[model samples]
Target: MTNDLLGRHRAVLPDWLALYYEEPLELTHGEGRHVWDAQGNRYLDFFGGILTTMTAHALPEVTKAVSEQAGRIIHSSTLYLNRPMVELAERIAQLSGIPDARVFFTTSGTEANDTALLLATAYRRSNTILAMRNSYHGRSFSAVGITGNSGWSPTSLSPLQTLYVHGGVRTRGPFASLSDEAYIAACVEDLRDLLGHTRAPAALIAEPVQGVGGFTAPPDGLYAAFREVLHERGILWIADEVQTGWGRTGEHFWGWQAHGRNGPPDIMTFAKGIGNGMSIGGVVARSEIMNCLDSNSISTFGGTQITMAAGLANLNYLLEHDLQGNARRVGGLLIERLRAVAAQVPAVREVRGRGLMIGIEITKPGTDEADPRTAAAVLEAAREGGLLIGKGGGHNTSSLRVAPPLSLNVAEAEEGAAILENALRSVR
Candidate 1:
């Protein structure tokens, strides 16, 4: 049955859409942190559908909200006044930390970021964009243009001239050997030098933690330092928080807050996890920047009623349960446990991330070169042991991505870790 489905999927779907496992399991249902395949084999879900299931699988609150809203109306478009959309927008605006903030909804992180590019270029009247090295923003043409990871970006043709910046990844770079303080200074100096050689760019867009380039991040205040230089040059700073927003990083509600000394960004784009599993994405900016577009615009399916309702419910549940704090406490423990497990495995190069978003980089034993084959072996072994994780990185997807739902408990974390440890050992 799985083989038949795989054949049909390959026939109908784009080749670029990658699936996991040698024989991918058809997940038919989920409950809490567990999901069951079509063959009724259950596994502990650590990837959370690429971290989109922020709260939990089959969350009752989100399900109820969606069903109730659907019974009344699923979508009324952005043409009519959407109460749910307005409510969700208001809540997000207050939490956004942008003064006099306005929110415009989209359906995916790609769309939100594309809208952000539109705003920044129009506001600053420049087509040049500064993007971080080894960062993954989205898959759209404009988003791909800004993306620095060569493996993920399929094209060089772009409307905007994008210049890749340094300091997104602290390890495996020219400045990797430097101390944290020295590294920040070197990156700042590099930014200043780049600015001198190029036309005034509209904005410097970056992820606080590079998601698809692996869960790598700069020092806490690196962005703050860069913000000072960009601010002086009238270059807007846009934080792409698609993977780092909504308290996923235990210590900060938003990833940019790790650099809070710099104040809020000129604009912020978000998408994944906001609606739990529902499609919800948007851009938040000060009214001045958001209103810069004189021409009228509307997203046909951006702020539809159903997705907004889901967002509202999910956000409420996340806040009410204090999932951020949970992520901090639980994620900290999970990382430590995984670190202990990784220490025993020679192929495990490094384990890095904050809160629930963690990455284990697999490498050749006692060497720095990435070992993607080992990573793939571990992924398959974990699945066979009833654990589901993810793999990503710029180095041919050599990192195991262990981002569970924010509601992950200690027992589940320990269980998942044990399975992962066994998988690593088996692979070795």
Candidate 2:
């Protein structure tokens, strides 16, 4: 009955529910990099559903696969075997570069993370999992538990059982700096202290480039150290690639690789855009961990007929189109444009990130204003100008997150960057 009412009021949000409002524009349809509003106005989708729609809307390849797969078999109960499921898992393992990695599918990024937590606990039996402060893992119970934010405290802290290393995502502090090797050492020490003092060590979970936590990407060796530490304690490492996986990053398909980790995680999870907005989530565990799970088990959802086909289509499209190379090429253009913008914009402090994931830190005049208000203004200004971008960070300062389709071309990059430049000039 509740769902029926929601279905009836498709575009309406209840007043009692907290909502985020920018200006006003209704989405009509989309092609590659453009979206049409209700009134037929077009907007450049730089944000791309907060970095979820990697292949853009309605690609021929993805749609065709979905159509064919749907006709044959949309879904089967977990009790049944399906080719799409096996193929998806097999591709993820081969693509992930982890020897003999295996996958378990879920419905969302958070669900994948939750499954990673379970797999970690079952294999390592460690009591604690470590994540970065202000990191956005997911909103679900266990996913939110590992998330290093006060928002979920008093709610999940008592039962969730997770530890946070360092108080900031952008910098290793109670220490200091980005682009520093010492910060990595400090974080490792912090993890050691937390583990030694707590005696609860199961897994270390992190986003290679923290999307919501100020868009910070720590040193390349950060994961390697964590992997080493966890292994020493008979614990496992988990990489939550919910946002950074696939070809979005450009140079590599997954964020863990960008950091130059020596080995693979015991469990790695994926969701967003694995099927180009289709309802698919997955966890790729090392063979040892995966083998321990009961073979008869399954990753099931009640209504899941369509997701399988959509996921296969999305994966095929990514492979055929060479979106990974596109990410690198256009991502390079974006970085150069951002650096140019920083040279001009006084409020802009630093522009950091790799591949398609980028962030601009807005600092206070004297103290380097990371003003959230300013960030919000930029976001709204961009929206009003028909460029869709989003913000991530713990502070009030705006930490801009730019993740577009992996297939975005150089022309789109120029248009998006130019629009952003004009918006910056308009902002106070």
Candidate 3:
């Protein structure tokens, strides 16, 4: 049975397709923030499955919800609404503060972004969207195009302007300590200049806080300027909060909230943390904007009964514990400790981000920017040291994105920090 399972896909999964697995572990089961491989080795999961497992791995409430929902109905087309779907959508709407919202659910963040892109297009009836460069939306065609990162997709396939990037490069001041006003001014100017083009834009897409282009939390004032400008030009502002939502960004339930009311977006996309690994993504839009969608068509399994049940359980967990507050507290401790770790190792360029979604920027010996090799090495060393982490930060260099569960404690963060520090020191 094991041989058969391994052989089934060997024909297509070639050695070159081993990017994510350059140092892969055969992790079998996970509980809370810890995972164990088939070999019985334990590792602290600092990456939290790329920020998806919000509550923790196989959390009791979430598992119970899935178990019960599975015994019941798992699929019901959107042609007819189910209780779970209705309740889950309502709960997210209320939590998100986007009332009168008509939810469209998908199975992944990419799909959600695809839906949001289509939604923006339908509402504005325009052919172009202004995308920030070095931004990452998703892996699907449309999502990839709007991702804002060069080399990730064909330049031609990209939205109207990939060159519209601003504040993407860490124009630094640790996001927590930065002057929010100054950061916003700089980003807003670049956005205005981008929109100054003769071509009309249907929408302007952004990550309230970028996840893939390193975990960057730009100034708070950016979104409002973009929103106001986009609205004045009759363009929608799409907030891709897949990584920042679900209490990962501290007191703010979503990245938009991190920006405050001043930067509230018109439409927001969420997925990673919503279902806690249930593979569900959602879109929330103002009722007026949704009016333009000819969305009578159905998705056979989008927000299925089981998916919604799981979503509700995740929602309950978030509210019951106020995980957002926990993220802020734990994230602060992580930043402080991580900075100290960097201070000990000169190769660490900087520590960036807010909440649990953070990154450690590394530099080569005497060279600036992160070192992709060092990044990969540190990732391997960390894993070897019993921790799980991820790498991104599109420069020639590499940075580790540390997105632990909101439920993570100061002690766990300290342990993860120790592992990371050891990993950084290992390169020598």
Candidate 4:
């Protein structure tokens, strides 16, 4: 049955939409941290649908909200006032650190980022953008242009002239050998040099932690340093928090807070998890930047009533349950356990990330070269052991990504860690 469905999926879907494992399982239902396949096999879900299920699978609160809202209305275009949309927007605006903030919703992170690009270019009157070296933004033309990862980006032709910047990844680059402070200095100097040779850029967009780049991140204050330089030159700082927002990082509610000594970013784009599986994406910026567009704009399905209902319920549950605190405590133990396991496995090149977002970089034994083959083996092994995980990296796709729901408990973390350890061992 799974094979038949896979055949149909491949026949109609874009070839670029990749699936995991040698044979993919058809997940039919989920509860808490566990999901059941069509064939009756159960597995612990660690990647949380690419980290979109922020709270839990089949969360009662979100489920109830969706059902209740659907009974009333699924959508009532932007032409009419939407109570749920306004309420969700208000909640997000208050939560967002940007002052005098305004919110505009989209259907996906890609659209959220695309909206951000429109605002930045209009506000700053420049088409040049600074993006991180190993970052993945979205699949849209503008987002793809700013995306520096070769694996995800397909075309060189773009609407915007993007300038790739350094400092997103702390390892595997010319400045990898430098100390934390020195690395920041070197990256900032590089940015300054790049600025001198280019047209005035509208903004520098970056992920607090490079999600598709193996969850890699630079020193805590690196962005603060970059903010200083960009602020002096009037270049806006845009934080792509699609994967790093809403306290997923444990220590910080927003990933940018780690380097927020200067203050919040000028604009922020978010999706994937805010609605807890519902299609909800948005951009938050100070009124000046958000309102820069001269013509009126609206997303036909951006802030639909049903999705807003889901977003409100999910956000409330996440905060009321203090999932961020849970993420810190449990994710701490999980990382330590994986680090211990990785120490015994030579193919495990490095273990990195914070909170529930972690990455295990696989490499050839006795060398620093990326080993995507070993990574694929570990992924398959983990699935065989009844655990669902994810894989990502730069062009090589050689890192194991582990981003479970923020509500994940200690027992689940330990169980997933054990399965992952055995998987890594099997591959080794």
Candidate 5:
């Protein structure tokens, strides 16, 4: 049955739409942090559908909201005043920390980032964009242009001229060995030099944690340092919070807060987790930036009633349950366990990240060279051990990604860690 479905999927879906594992398991249903495959096998879900199933699978509030809203009306184009949409927008606006914030909804993070680019370029009257090295924004044309990861970026032709910057990854770079303050200074100096060589950029777009880039991040306060430079140059800061928003990092509600010494970003984009699997994305910016366009613009299908309802319910549940606190507590234990186990595994190069967004980088036993084959083997082993995790990195996708729902508990964290430890050892 799985083979037949695989054949059908390949025949219909794009070739680039990759699947996990050599024998892709068909996940039919899920509840909380666990999912059941078509074969009735239950696995502890750590990846959370690339960190999209934020709160949990089959969360009651989100499920009920989606069901109730669907019965009333699934979609009412942005033409009319959507109560759910308006309410959700108000909540997000207040949460965003951007003064006089206005929200515009899109169906995915790609669209949200695209909308942000449009606003920034129009407002600054510049087509140049500054993006971090090893960053992955989205798959759309504009988002692709700003994406600095070669594996994810398929084309170079773009409407906006993008200049890749440094300091996103902290472990493997020219400044990797420097102290945190020194690294920040070096990157800032590099940015100042880069700015001298290029046209004034409209914005510097970045992910607080590089999701597809193996969950890599620079020292805290790195972006704040960059923000000072960009601000002086009149370049806007756009924080891509698709994966890092809503306290997934455990430390802050938004990723940018890790670098918020200067303040919040000029424009902030978000999507995954807000709707707990429902399609919902949005951008928040100051009124001056959001309302810069002279002509009209509207997302015909954005902010649909049902998606907004789901988002509101999900957000409420996340807040009321204090999932951020849960992530911090559970994630701390998980990472510590993984690190202890990794110390005994030669193939495990590093274990890094905050909150629920953890990554284990696989590499050769005695060198810095990435061993993607070992990473893949560990991933396959984890699945065999009844655990579902994800993999990503700049060096041929060699890092194991473990981002469970924000509501992950200490018991589940320990369970997942044990399985992952065995998987890592098996690969070595």
Candidate 6:
């Protein structure tokens, strides 16, 4: 059955739409932290559909809200007052930390970021943009234009004049050997130099933690320093929080808070966890930037009743249960355990990230060269051992990404870590 379905999928889907494993497992159903493949094989879900499952699988509150909202009205084109949309927007705006915030909903992170680009360009009257090295915004044409990772970015054509900045990844770069303070200084200097060569950019868009760049992050306060420079030039700061938002990073409610010295970003884009499994994405900005558009615009399916209902319920459950605290506690232990395991493995180049968004970079034994084969082998082995993880990196996709549900408990953390350890050993 799985083989037949795979054939059908290959025939129908674009070849560029990649799937996990050599033989991809068809996940049919899920419960809290666990999912069953089409053939009845159960695996502990650590990736959570690329970290989209925020609370847990089949969370009752979100499920109830979605079901109830669907029963009444699933969608109404953004022509009328949407109570759920308004409520969710109010909550997100208040939580966004931007003064006089306005929220615009989209169907995906790509759309959210595209909207942000539109706002920034229109407001600032420039198509020039600054994005960090090893950063990924989204997959849309506009979003892809700003992406800096060569592996994920398939084209050089872009609507925006994008300047790739330094300091998104701190592990392997010209300034990787520097201390945190020196690295930040070097990046700031680099940004200053880059700005000298180009027209003033409309905005500098960055992910607080570079999600597709193997969960890599600049040192704390790096962005704050850059923000100082950008602010001086009246350039906007946009944080792409698609994967790092909603307390996944633990210490901060928003990933940008790690660089909070300059207050919130001028604009923020989010998706992939806000509505749990529901498709909900949005952009938040001060009204000055958000209201820059002079013409009428609406995302037909954005802020629909069902998705907003799920988002509201999911956000409520996340805050009520303090999932951020859970992410901190459990993810702290999990990273420690994985670090211990990695210390014994030469292929494990580095273990990094905050909270549940951890990454294990795979390299050739005793060398810094990325080992994508070993990473792929470990992924396959882990799946065989009843664990599901993800892989991403700027260097040939050689990093193991471990982002469990924020509600992950200690026992599951331990279990996943043990399985990952065995998988690493098998690959070695």
lDDT of 5 by residue, 7-32 (tens): 99999999999899899989999999
Residues 1-428, model 3: lDDT tens digits: 43454555466686434345453566689998998877798999988778888888999999999999889878878888588888988887777767577677888888888888888887777768777666888877777777665645544564433345566554542332346676667677767887786477778788877788778656665677667766677777788889888778785777787555554567888898888888889888888876677656678878888888888998899889988899999998898889987887878878878888887877786666557887888888988899898877767537788998889988899999999888988896
Cα error, residue 265 of model 1, in Å, equals 0.6
TM-score of 6: 0.99
Angstrom error at residue 57, model 6:
0.5
Question: Backbone collision count in every prediction?
Answer: 0, 13, 1, 0, 0, 0
* Per-model TM against the reference: 0.99, 0.91, 0.92, 0.99, 0.99, 0.99
RMSD values for the candidates in order, in angstroms, are: 0.8, 3.4, 2.9, 0.7, 0.7, 0.6
Cα TM-score of candidate 4? 0.99
lDDT of 2 by residue, 1-428 (tens): 43454445556875544323343454668898888876677889887777778788877877887787678777776677766677776777898777888777788888888877777777776657777777778777777778775543325643457778762354535666544577778878888888888866677788887877767876677778777877788777778888888867778878888655566666788888787877777788878887775655665572255776677778887888888888888898898998898788887777887778888777664465468777777777787787888777766536888888888888889999988887776774
lDDT of 6 by residue, 3-51 (tens): 9999999999999999999999999999999999999999999999999
The per-residue C-alpha lDDT of model 5 at residue 336 equals: 95
Candidate 5 Cα outliers beyond 4 Å, as residue runs: none
* True-structure lDDT of candidate 1: 0.94
> What C-alpha lDDT values do all the predictions have?
0.94, 0.75, 0.78, 0.94, 0.94, 0.95
- Give lDDT: candidate 5, residue 425: 84
